[model samples]
Target: MAKYKTLIFILEGSLLNEKVAEQNALRQTLKLTGREYGPTERIQYKSLQEKTKLLGFDERIKLTLQEFFKNDWISAKGAFDNQLQKQDQLNKDVLPFLDEVKNKVNLILLTKEKKDVASYRMQNTELINYFSAVYFKDDFACKFPNKKVLTTILQQQNLTPATCLVIGTNLVDEIQGAENANLDSLWLAPKKVKMPISPRPTLHLNKLSDLLFYLELS
Candidate 1:
């Protein structure tokens, strides 16, 4: 029998190369503001990124522009919005991995993105077909790391915490969210990112394809 009755997947970073998209958008934003991306900016951006995890997407962009361009931040924010809307691509291994596990367990896509954005991205990438259900921030009326989001999902799906696994790339959002909900979690750790010592995920893997082996589907 399958170990998990349901697998909750985070849309960004887990299935999509959202970090690449964000980096591309950041570079485009910098270019629009007549600045270049250098080591200093990279370091600063990473620091800011970590600090702004709880903020909404627009707020993060606004803060990023303000940090880089004090006088021209407003215009840069608009540019960043346009740049971000054009970004979003699935990780190369996503389709094959999803195919392998689609029948083994229920696949649920959960994202903090609003319905319009999430639907557009999934439609563009043809990812909606793989998921049995997709839940967005709009549906929950709250962003993740809130235990209620997971609990609600569990209640709606008639699942127990022990029988479901939350898979995500972000520690604060996915892993912590799962922990808060008292559910098992699998972290698809981002490259060069350090794993936290406390509140760690139940399992950690380097890539989406690695899940096949961990899940005994290989």
Candidate 2:
């Protein structure tokens, strides 16, 4: 039998190359404003985004754009959104990994993205067919790292925390959320970054394909 009855995946960085998408979006936004940004600016922008993550998506985008541009921030935000949609792509390992375990456990996508954006990205990547269900930010009515969202998902899916595994790339959101909910979590750290002592995930993987070995052993 499979170790977990359900595998809840974080859609953005887990399945999709969100870093690439975000970088591309930022580049497009800069182009729209006729501005040039280097690694330093990108790092600062990312830090700012992290600090403002609690805000709604639109608000966060607006605030981030305002920090860099004096005017036409709305147009920059629109350009970023449009470019993000076009730039979002599935990780190379996503297809092969999912194919190996899709039949073993129920696949659920839990995303902080709004329904429309999440749906568009999933459909664009041809990932919509693989997941049994998708829970959008709209469904939860709150940002991530909230235990309530996980508990709500468990109740709706008729699952216990022990029977489910949360997989995500973001430590603060996905791993911490699972920890708060008392669920097992697998951290997909592509760069093999050292995990912190607090809010540690149950498992740490260097790549998405490693999950197949874990599932087999479990």
The per-residue C-alpha lDDT of model 1 at residue 64 equals 77
Checking candidate 1 for backbone clashes, the offending pairs are none
**lDDT of candidate 2 at residue 138, scale 0 to 100:** 93
- lDDT of candidate 1 over 45-64, digit per residue (tens): 89988887545455766787
TM-score of each prediction = 0.83, 0.81
Candidate-wise lDDT, in order: 0.80, 0.79
TM-score of 2: 0.81
Lowest-sum lDDT 10-residue window in model 2:
52-61
